[model samples]
Target: MIRDYSQRLVVQEVAPRDGLQIEQKWVETDDKIALIDNLSACGFTRIEAGSFVSPKAIPALRDGDEVFHRIGRRPGVIYVALIPNVKGAERALAAHADELNLVMSASETHNRANMRMSCEQSLAGFGDIVRLVAGSGASLNATVATAFGCPFEGRIDEDRVASIVDTYREMGMQGITLADTTGMANPRQVARIVERVLGRIPAEALTLHFHNTRGLGLANVLAAYEAGARRFDASLGGLGGCPFAPGASGNICTEDLVAMCEELSIPTGIDLLKLIELSRTLPALVGHDVPGQVAKAGRNCDLHPVPAYVRTI
Candidate 1:
């Protein structure tokens, strides 16, 4: 296997949108803007700032419009908004989102549960959205949720995924994301699928979104990286998950992923110390502890003073 770990990785921070979507306590719109603005300063080129879904669906991010309009847009950063349909796409465009992320599940059951539409219906709707966004100057990204494995259907066929990728390319999508929504993917599976997708999708245009449900998020990232995938979606403090998918947990943590890349000598261009400081405030934001480790344990290079007793001894 070609194991090239030296290539730079691009991490898309999704804390404001994916990370806060499932929270029981609503993250104030002001805090969400602050979070996105702070993350913007951390060298992320892409940040999923919010989504335009119904407030009834994800009430926490209902203020997406306000947040998008108010946040300080960094000169080089791209602010992305997740959209499920033409309406959401319109709302995103109205908010002046830099990119529109459209998501549909590979599994029929998950699609029905999450999007309230079938795969065919989702694709049909995507065509409308593509037409709507045409000439709007906002790029589009089609995310295939549960591309690796499904909670209800299990083991999505690789060919099925490739067909979806091909459709997105044909539809003129600027980017595509394969999401392990329930964290069911392993390293071997990730590498295999990434290699196949890379055959069709360029590494820069492809993004991998993994969850830490089974504690293999970073492992999968490495696998995808080794297989020539450079872009990844990670949430701050490992917050957020698929509310419709059973056993789904928060996404791979941004700080942890960056730390791993830093240790391996892969440049992510993110400020690790600033990221950790931002991660430390998540518990208060959500009113609960988070799943990310590097934030709590500190980076590997963080050193503590020698114990007073040991020094005296």
Candidate 2:
């Protein structure tokens, strides 16, 4: 049963953009479209269709615009595209994305290595993207990468993240997402920083993006939820790793996260069984065992009726 006063948690499906970006074999455009359509059919209201980045940077996602154009858009569903710079933003707008997600790293070293720019330069570049999407009839979200900690520069300062969050709001961003790019977040840190961030920014506008590098993804998420964050960014099947961050693992598994939410009576509004089935297909496509637990062990509600002979025991 749904909780009477449960806060609605929005899951932004990041499989296409974050999930496939790390694959060795390029996922065919048709396959990508089918994945998006299948996810849409499963009642995912927000699907990140693709990213508009330099093919030189991420070769697997070279056809971002084509993917966005080919996807069948549902009335209430949002198709988000990751735009790295102004050029990428232009491409996303031309393809008619429902939302633009602009990303930047909080760690200066990671920022330089990842985007070839400093933290300040990245924020300045975001201003240009903000200008580009100001009148395009689409929502723009600013994602502060490495918000928790960075592999290149460990333990990012909370004040810096809060400063960026304040800056994003000043730039007219409707929402802000804190990305644990290297999966270094812990529950205690999540609660403490989120408590401070929420003091300035309203809880509804904040989203949490976690990675499972050290296997603390769900713990960090629960901490954030308790801190009043309602939006989450999850990749289907636990696919995706930061290209710039060495030793970083894939994203938080959608099925596992959904199962946790449902068990907690948090009202995530996702079908866990369908999500687990969707996760099974990913291991073969990507050629590895994803870190999702729900696919391995069925959800709590998945009970098999005992056979007549077994019932005698």
Candidate 3:
């Protein structure tokens, strides 16, 4: 059933921003730029390079300004930066980011802890941001963090998430990324939520962001894809997680996603082998082990024939 997608798959790399943000060690600016450069060569149309969050909150990505300024822009590759508020938006615009991603949590508890604002207040401020960036060449987007579930609040209601999405739509935003910040989603919930949200808004407007916390990240992606989700958020070497969500690993791996698409004859336009090669350099950069499976195991088509001598055993 997963192989039945008639639409082309869109994979958006979020390693530079979401992936690196949660790391304990610092990733150098040039290295981050090199990582972006590597992914750019892989035919990813949308790559989230960095974010504008404060240094105090996320010191690992403090060099966002430098990373943005240093990376050489590849033609046709959309380099997006996540912005938390107007200040972040201003910084992103100054850095010449191709797109600006704003975010707020669906649950009040998580929103207060992560963003320190109520849901209603954040939505009200989103309108102000929309007006502020009206003439900017950069595209404006808002990610609904913890749309699937929140660590602080436990299970999140679908209707509440739908309300937030409706608010985002009212802002005339072209894109909205629904994030599983705590990796609490399963296949059934993913399909149900994506189906309902996409019904209210266009499928093109919704992007699913899943964390591999419970080992259901890929399954959730499959569920959303079957429910008509086209774009997904992935990281090279599976490099990211919520600082708030304990034991949560990085995002869905880019190489694994590409391999799935390739095996299914879907047009992802990304080369998995090259992306896996790029993932090898990530461990030293982040000073930790990554969680991507395809980085360690070869694709299904990459299997070798069993030797006759081994078969005899």
Quick one: best lDDT, which candidate? Answer: 1
User: What digit string (tens of lDDT, one per residue) describes model 2 on residues 1-313?
Assistant: 4324278778888989998987888889998998898888777888888999999988999999889998998789989998889999999999999899888888888888878888788889988988888888999889898999988789899999999899999999888889998888999999998899899888778889999888899899888887778888898878887665545567998888888888777787677777788788887777777767788888887798878998678
Residue lDDT tens for model 3, 143-249 = 99889888878899889899888888888888998999888999999999999998888887889999888889888988999888999999998888656656667
Clashes of 2: 0
Candidate 1: tens digits of C-alpha lDDT, residues 1-313: 5456778999999989898888899788889999999999989999999999999988988999999999999999999999989999999999999999999999999999889989999999999999999999999999999999998998999999999999999999999999999889999999999999999989999999999888899999998998899999999989886555445456999999999999999999999999999999999989988888999999888898997899677
User: Ranking by TM-score, best first?
Assistant: 1, 3, 2
Instruction: Single out the weakest 10-residue window by summed lDDT for candidate 2.
Output: 1-10
Query: Residue 102 error for model 2, in Å?
Result: 1.2
Estimate the lDDT of model 3. 0.87
Error of 1 at 100 (Å): 0.4
Model 1 residue 194 distance off true place after TM-score fit, in angstroms: 0.4
Query: Residue 37: error of model 1 in Å?
Result: 0.4
Residue pairs in candidate 3 whose N, alpha carbon or C atoms collide under 3 angstroms: 240-250
lDDT of 1 at 54: 96
Q: Can you list the residue pairs that collide in candidate 1?
A: none
